[model samples]
Target: METSSLDQVRAAEFASGGATAYLATASCGLLPRRAVEAVTALAERNATGSRGGAGSFDAVDRARAGFARIAGVDPGRVSTGGSVAVHVALVAASLPAGAEVLAPEGEFSSVVSPFAVRGDLRMRYVPLAGLAEAVRPETALVALSAAQSSDGRVADLDAVRAAAAAHGARTLLDASQSAGWLPLDAGAYDYTVTGAFKFLMCPRGTSFLTVTEEAQETLPVLYAGWLSAEDRWNSTYGPVRRLAADARRYDEPVAFLAYHGAEHALALVAEVGVDALYEHATGLAARFREGLGALGHPAVPGTSAIVAVPGLGAREPELADAGVLVSNRAGNLRAAFHVYNTEADVDRALDVLAR
Candidate 1:
């Protein structure tokens, strides 16, 4: 698709981020106009004491459905949460005592730290490229990010899944960096978690998880609350005779304003289609990566939405001051391309970095 074609989306949905170029979707995505309005509407409703926040459940339900569609899973398989770490903790607690957990080295703390804190579980780390080959018979679970945050190297989902299956180990995929643009098959993994703020372009408090039926049977509903019941109204002030029949059993009380925004944010993702965003963003990333190499900067090589050049982290402040927004991650200058960005945005950042 031509670069001009995406300008309408940038103008309509993302007209407000105060930057000459926004290449920081890896850090946080700018909210769309519709999402801003949705959040404002919810705040006004709350101010008027309408339903005392009961209306949030409707938004929460729609967000759940939107995420289910984005991740290619049934709505019943998805559960709402405020963060990835909490969901990781739940999965971590479900493991057998002293079970060996395998993960990629430098895996995000939200994924690896939960298992580490357990201390009972044996945690093993391998290079991201070798994750599949390292899976052993004794491995109980393989937890990792779909795309690495520090550097945007995407994990090989198929190879890892096949390896885990052969070893009878479960899989937990953190889709935080890949969900909005990268095509995701949440159902293929035993469990998948996403902190949607970064790429899904929602409020910070929104996150989601998908649990397979076999995996669901294994995870204890340790975080159950009123929403955990099949009928929440009946669940109040009781022994909770019937819990949610599906993954909803793991639901937490949502951040009301956040989900209200998420409802619109995820709708925008559905409207654009992940494949289109993938083509657009990766095209911009490739352009930027090529530009960086020509400038004698060595970037982490990949066709990922994020492109990071090492030894250039110190340039981030100067780049931002020049109005080309980006991030510095683990000593690499990281620029994330997203649907809202354009060729001009990429070139503007490149131009600033060249100086």
Candidate 2:
């Protein structure tokens, strides 16, 4: 589709959601119509005993390919996981001993806990302002969230990657909140992790990790399961010594049927084009910030799509009762916007705050 035409379609889709304010893309996103249809079709297929054998294989392959395309990586470099946190832990555990990991001070617990618990690993918490100065030759890894979950502050990835390169450190990004709303340059990092449920508009429990070619050779396998083996399901397979070159080396064997819903959701996002979806979301977020300013609830300076506005010291429950749904983070009301939200929704949310 032409760029303008695609933008118009996105705008119309956002407008069709009606007047209910949905400023929560950071927490969850509204599933698109196509995703809903795909989920239903998958559910029906499962009900009719079409889930196994050749059909299931095709379904799984399509899902992997869809994820790889969105991530801007080769299909062989993508792996499915139950959650982004799980994959982050897996990556952390696989790093070499005595590795020093540099991360933000107030990052999500999932990103912090894995590296913190290792006896041989040293964790350094870099202040947001001093991240560039924290990189050192001893640092083996630099892990960070693409966007700060608390206030939607985006990291300067170019600088971060450059610093890590100078220190001979591998970079890993937790892109759970930024993937669907921003253009991801896969060539810039060693590994990128994301969850499908949040911005990808998929069901919960669907997550993925994209690894670079260098990571494939250097990183050790932390959670190698049957599926991660070279010939996991081959009937004639004897003991296999080599792991698959693909990112399938990170996948676990247990399958969650609900993941089909998440896979279908990701496919829809890919069809819509992530760049277009990101533009729509950022535009809506700008409108929402403007509306919030008019209501005397200005967003924190330098905030991105996941904006945080002061609640005038009101409790979070009070804001919810006022007909606005948002998250409370560090004494601020967090608001998010996605492709399915309209300007009218922002106005309505502001109206609630005005009361």
Q: Which candidate ranks first by TM-score, i.e. highest? A: 1
TM-scores, all candidates, are 0.97, 0.88
List runs of model 2 lying over 4 Å from the truth. 1-19, 44-55, 235-241, 254-256, 310-319
Task: Give a tens-digit lDDT track for model 1, residues 213-267.
Answer: 9998889898777789999998888677799999999998879889999999999
Report the C-alpha displacement of residue 258, candidate 2, in angstroms: 3.9
Model 2's TM-score against the true structure: 0.88
Positional deviation of residue 234's Cα in model 2 after best superposition, in angstroms = 1.4
Error in Å for residue 323 of model 2: 4.3
Clashing pairs in 2: none
lDDT value, candidate 1, whole model: 0.91
Error of 2 at 60 (Å): 2.6
